[model samples]
Target: MGLKSVLSKVFAARVNRELNYLRKNAIALQQKTFTDLVDAAKDTAFGKAHNFAQINNYQDFKANVPVHDYEDLRPYIDRVVKGEENVLWPGKPKYLAKTSGTTSGVKYIPISKESMPQHIKAARNALLSYIHETGNADFVDGKMIFLQGSPVLAEKNGVSTGRLSGIVAHHVPAYLQKNRLPSYATNCIEDWEQKVDAIVEETHNQDMRLISGIPPWCQMYFDRLSAKAGGKKIKDIFPNFKLYVHGGVNYEPYRTRMEDSIGFGIDSIETYPASEGFIAFQDSQKEKGLLLLVDSGIFYEFIPSEEYFNEKPTRINLKDVELEKNYALIMNTSAGLWGYSLGDTIKFISKDPYKIVVTGRIKHYISAFGEHVIGEEVEHALMSVAKQEGIDVVEFTVAPQVNPPAGQLPYHEWFVEFGTPPANLQAFAIKVDKALQTKNIYYFDLIEGNILQPLIIQSLQKDAFINYMRSEGKLGGQNKVPRLANDRKIADGLKGYIS
Candidate 1:
């Protein structure tokens, strides 16, 4: 066998064995993970304050450590930034991943030496697992272009900090460094537009095989490459391209445009990596769920999405989860974050190896009319409507029209940027409205009671979301517009640029 074929088989065999072990010993693995985390942090300031040494099981851990979001952990994080050792974890963190939410404000999250390897390993394994399952290793023989954020890092209080993608980019295996696209100088350009132009000039003729990026940015890269090649499809330029690994946003809405850009359907792998930790990734091509990393140095807890906003919420671990329940995920990481809210909601699709799909963000939902619509429901409604109407959704978002122009019942306002407009515009709106009514009972009742009017469909200018994000200084790299908002924030903002 050729070297590529031989290495592919070896990796496939090793990943299969690892997957089997995780599946077989899931419970034991999870319990041991909890035990190890508690043991390691028992004497740190956070652990000591919470009496971590006395914690012996999931019950004890939950009872002592309260669930927290970034704001909740700010005090400890502030201390960590001030060069405090053993503030949250056992020692000082070497790096911090800076992130911001839709509402605005920066969150500096610790990346301890203990936790860095977990992120790296999860990313590497995500690609390897895909290769193992699909027997597609020839792609690795060529270059894989990771459209990453800048690799240049900044420091604060003797600790380095930058975008998670940037930090991860710097640590890519030296062997792949020879084949990874976007020169280090291009990655350091700092301006998104300038970088894209530089990237286009640099990669137009390279023999690329795999592409990884968040969908919108990937869409932008593909568009630039195609434009430079004079309307040629990405496949025409790089025939060897095979895999498209993406995350940071739902890939469904962007699928059609992406396929059109590449001129073909390429295999894709999804992951759920956050600043807190590398969470999960698509593991089986036969299955639809992402395999949760059981022993990946992070302990997990789940709060039912319905009860998460309630006064008293039920917290469960690996041993107590059920399939098909909406959950707000919480993590106690290899870093010293105890019960930190990742802000994302997810649903379990499989349990043997603990597989899940990200449902939405805890705050990224619309219940404006008591409809309690979640991100998963919005995605399903849009996809269903688009499929039936035979149109392609480029991007979309919704907000409650709490106050309309009078004589009209308040309802949802949907801003859609379509790749291909439907022949009958009313049919598109009807389908979108009808699909939501079927999925959400409160929405159905509001429509039936005539308390809410038919949903408004406002066509958005092509690149509206990209422009809006650019205005907010979040044009590229891990930024996304919330598909559903509880109020007029996202909707009003987009209305300013409607087509």
Candidate 2:
């Protein structure tokens, strides 16, 4: 083994020990993080406005501060963007993670100096944990690639600003710089397709062992590689590739096709990260969910997802969460975000060390007819049926078809791009509809009452989703199609590619 690979094993052992301590003292670690965040920000403008000085406990903090979405805290954020110091967090934010907002347009989330290391640490620990568990550090000697947005950042009020991934790209440790793939110049290419082509040209013959990105972009990279190699499997192109690290979306929908593209199943690590904070990561391959990072520089709160929109929803601390129930993830971060709604829902699978699975987005659900179908249910239904029928799904989205054609009942419309088309499309649709009904009772009741018909599958042509995403100028870099929507915006846009 090379010196770096030997050192990686040693580092992995040390990190695993620290992780065990954190897991064993999960509640205590969370309590300390909570207190630390409140105390650190108590002198800031928001702190003064919210009575943070007088807060002594979780209850005190909760009573003093209210949960805030971007708009709710925009006034303070606006000041920070205008170069105001001590407006939100301590003095000045180190960087603002720019993200596209739905209702609010462009959103700038603060990333403080203190909070920055937490992101880097959590990501590093995820890999180290994998190395420790599997005793595989040989990949450390090989090239690694992360498909991401350009690293070139812009100045906003004298603070560096860019997409979270781009901001993170600037922080890759010096030790790994030599092993990282896709030359900086290639990565800086503005267009994602061009970037992928450049990346392929630069790294196809290298000793690639670790590949990381959101699954869709990784799929795109694999497709480009296959085309270049005359349809050869990805395993043939990079025989040493050992791990596939992904986040931002559930991997189940893309799992079958990704494995097929690679010609084998591979180990994957799922992480739960956001502009707000690095929340959790897969610490064990045998575990079912990502281990929540109780020791990270963020304090967590959870509101029962069903009660999220209700007036004054019940918010509870991490220690109060129960298994199997979904909750809207709320956080108080060192970045000066207090009671910030992350807009994502998660369900705890294990409480011993606080492990969770990303369930869906709070806003991304279909309830046009009051059925309230979520991303998890739809993904589960679709993948389950597809598995039983021996089919391969490339990508899919679900939107309510409230207005159907003449003489037809309104129903849920599923836009599915199939890698392997079913021999009987109607039978496949029936199986998926039945599977969905079993997952959600509301949809089942609606179907039985004739309020909604069984879901109709709009089989898409090859690369339909890729084309749609490209047309919308969201081809890559943390972009993903919503699994379920209440309206037909995406459904309408996808009409042209329907087979």
How does each model score on lDDT? 0.86, 0.92
TM value for model 1:
0.98
Q: What is the lDDT of residue 465 in candidate 2?
A: 90
Q: What's the C-alpha lDDT at position 219 in model 1?
A: 91
- Clash pairs detected, candidate 2: none
Worst 10 residues of 2 by lDDT: 34-43
Error of 2 at 330 (Å): 0.4
Q: Lowest summed-lDDT stretch of 10 residues in model 1?
A: 1-10
Q: Write the per-residue lDDT of candidate 1 for residues 111-218, one digit (tens) a residue.
A: 988889888888888888877777778876787788888888999889999999999987888767888888999988888988888988888888888899999889
Candidate 2 lands at a TM-score of 0.99
lDDT of 2 by residue, 216-322 (tens): 89999999999999999999999999899999999989999999999899999998889889999999998799999988888999999999999889999988899
Q: Give candidate 2 misplaced runs (Cα > 4 Å).
A: none
